[model samples]
Target: MATDKPCKNLHRSPSPAQCMDHYGCIYENNHLITLLVDPENGRIADANRAACEFYGYSLRQFRQLLICDLAADPKSGVQEFVEKALPAGDEQSNRMFIDRHVLASGEPIDVEVHTGMMKMLGKNCVYTVIHDISERVSSEQRLRESEERYRDLVELCPEAILVYSGGIILFVNKQTERMFGNKKQELIGKRIEDFFNEVYFQSAEHNKLKTTGLLKERFRIEQRLIRRHDNRIFDLEISGVPVIYEEDKALQLVIRDITESKRELERAIRLQEHRHAVSFPLDSKAVLEKLYIPARTLSGDFFLFHKINEKQVIGIIGDVTGKGITAALNISALRVMFMDSLLSTQNPVQVLNDLNLKALQYLGEDYIAGCCFLFDFGTGLLKAAGAGINEFLYVPRGRDCERITVKGAPLGMFESSEFEEKSIPFESGDRFCFYSDGMELLFNSDELGRDYGYLIERFAGAALQDDCTWLGLNIQ
Candidate 1:
């Protein structure tokens, strides 16, 4: 219920108290800056206390000023202010406008103005409510600038990037266009399946990854893609991370071309497998059984055996300090040196001494854990020297296995390194086992029983973290 009561003095502009009695305290006491203006001329008739404080103007000064004078741009602001204040179809309907207003101190501030036509003091007047939005505008501007910077970074990225949702490609970076040999217009709004090979894209593993990616899980997979211009299939490593695009859940995929690298890796694997291949010599009195397992495509472990005579065989089993192609190349160099050393000496200690000198000269900073041994079947004796790999298992027929350790420093470690040689006389039905340090994962103690075959089976099934090598000799 409202009452429109005429004030005592209606001829002059109303004071704050008089305006409050006419329009209620809401217009004068409201925190938001409120103003009353003549709709026809955009002349400010009255203003609240908040408006006076916000604009640095007293109520008397505000009454003398025009509403257009408060706008940053006064020329067009005059027409704009008057046009909003004038009554249209619905006079009570509020119209909102965002504009810049100048304060008394000459500082421009962004403001949201809500204007409506209303009857005040028996005349059609405009009621204006102003809300300062400078902070919100500043934040929005910073957000836009940040988005522009992120878009620039994405465009300059080296790897192909794509944003996809529901199997359809929503966005593609410049690198993606160059990699797929397609233009921006050609790739956008296309299905991701269209660019990928049909057989691989539809695979169960690939579908599983797609499902996982949609669930916001990060995933990586190797896929084959068909080039649109050439129709040539190429390998691609696609790493996907969940992202939001246009307010919808999507996936961003980083794709790398790995065709050349994959081919080079395959060639290296074949070469390493050939380098590790061993051919045993034919001997009736001695039986040699070995197991070699690599943790990767290339192994650090290497073994070489040369027959000195029908009665004697000399061998060396070594593990380099590192793995991969470098270790494989070191193993090849050591193999050639081992063969040359056999020509000079048949003694285990002298062979290691010669190899150590060569390793110091050629192997650079790398060290080797090695065990060299000479077995004589006719004399029934085994002589072995160790460098880093010091333990050996000796199992005699119908007796418990004995642990034999030959102490020596690792090769290429010191110039004055001394090696100890252990000579054990063997009888008929005795077994000697020599292994690299990786074999310690199976048996930590010195007592490793007679069954070498069972240990090999267990090693085959066990999860191995390093390269392992085992060589066994049986005297029959």
Candidate 2:
């Protein structure tokens, strides 16, 4: 070890030789990879034991090589680093550089080099401390790759995705660009509230709560948005979740277009209303009145009255097993079949049996609770058959009301279902009411009455949980 130069003050009584020996011992035995380089020519003047072992090179071989020989990039050698690291005053300056270095084994490794000015044998030199940062660099590179993959997934997503911070748009996916009719470059850095109507913000307080970190959980809401290109307003269902994006708290919004769905809903409402608005045959002499109330936009309850001639009318009232479009479709199919069955036979028993066969073929597992009745003004007799609806209200002239029940299984349950038929004598000034099961709230067997007006008033005020339909026939 060369120890001619004295070290900085170690103690009061330490001699020059003793200080030099102490400095050499620490420098050579240090655990950190250290090197002494000639600042003028980028030559490696000396290397510590740690440096020799780390680079897989002997001390003599390291001394024979220039500093640029170890550098992965020859342009960023020690001389350039030392010149940039020189201090303005007499004070020693320290600088840090991240670069790649090649080992004696010809393997490239990432390194963080800390350089400072120093003197060795009365010549200016640069003392460098090297730290192997391969692991840290590898971790950062992996993180970048993961972020890139996440961005690709977001871009390829089917729904429109938007990321915003403090109500200012930070990012938007390709679907968002297509939905808003705007380029991503035009949308990014813009305010999110500009495109959406007042429905999105709701109130100033809601907007504040949304932009701030107070709302952290996922939430969904429907709002109207205007396209930037054509200014066309459309409905959108937006679901938002709070996320950490680019080290900042942001809201990631997933949006779905619900414009077509809303339109279909409106069309269904109109069709259901038209179905409820029943038009009785003008040629029929009997006074027929009905009240149909649906709990939802679509009703499963249905009633149809077909006037056979001037004195005879055949009618059916039923409730399908389920709700919504499926039930509505079943009701329509059954109505068409009922009309066709009446053409073949006006008998209540044959009409119901025909309908049961059609229901089994068309309805699959679904069923219908219904009653088919034939009223004959010519014979002054009413014939009724029950499938699932087993009861009817019978009011005789100047006599007490009676609950007439004809019991049988609902349609579509069995291939050979046997329905029971009932015949009752009727006269002038008597009345009858046929209703679906939804009217059970007001009319049980014991509550049979002739006052249809009062029952309708009470039913109008009640909270209906299902579809209700009732048809009244006054014997005129």
Of candidate 2, the 10-residue stretch with the lowest lDDT total is 82-91
Question: How much is 205 displaced in model 1, in angstroms?
Answer: 2.5
Query: lDDT per prediction?
Result: 0.80, 0.80
Any runs in candidate 1 off by more than 4 Å, and if so which? 1-24, 52-61, 73-75, 82-90, 208-213, 280-476
**Which pairs clash in model 2?**
none
Candidate 1 similarity to native, TM-score? 0.72
TM-score of model 2 relative to the true fold? 0.59
Model 1 has a clash total of 0
lDDT by residue for model 1 (292-393), tens = 766633457878888888888888888887656567677878888889888899899998898889889988899988999888878889999999889788
Assess the local accuracy of residue 123 in candidate 1 as a C-alpha lDDT between 0 and 100.
88
Q: For residue 351, give model 2's deviation from the true position in Å.
A: 14
| Candidate 2 residue-wise lDDT, 1-476, digit = tens | 88676666645696678767987999999999999888778788889999999999999999898887988876776555555545443326688888789999999999998888887656787888999999999999999999999899999999999987887888999999888777999899887656655455766544742475655788877666676557787877878888888889888888899888667656655666777677656334467777777673455788888888877878888888765666668787888888888879999989989989988998899998899988888898999999999889888878887889988789999889999999998987888888888576556644446466766676776557787877777777
**Cα distance off (Å), candidate 2, residue 263:** 1.2
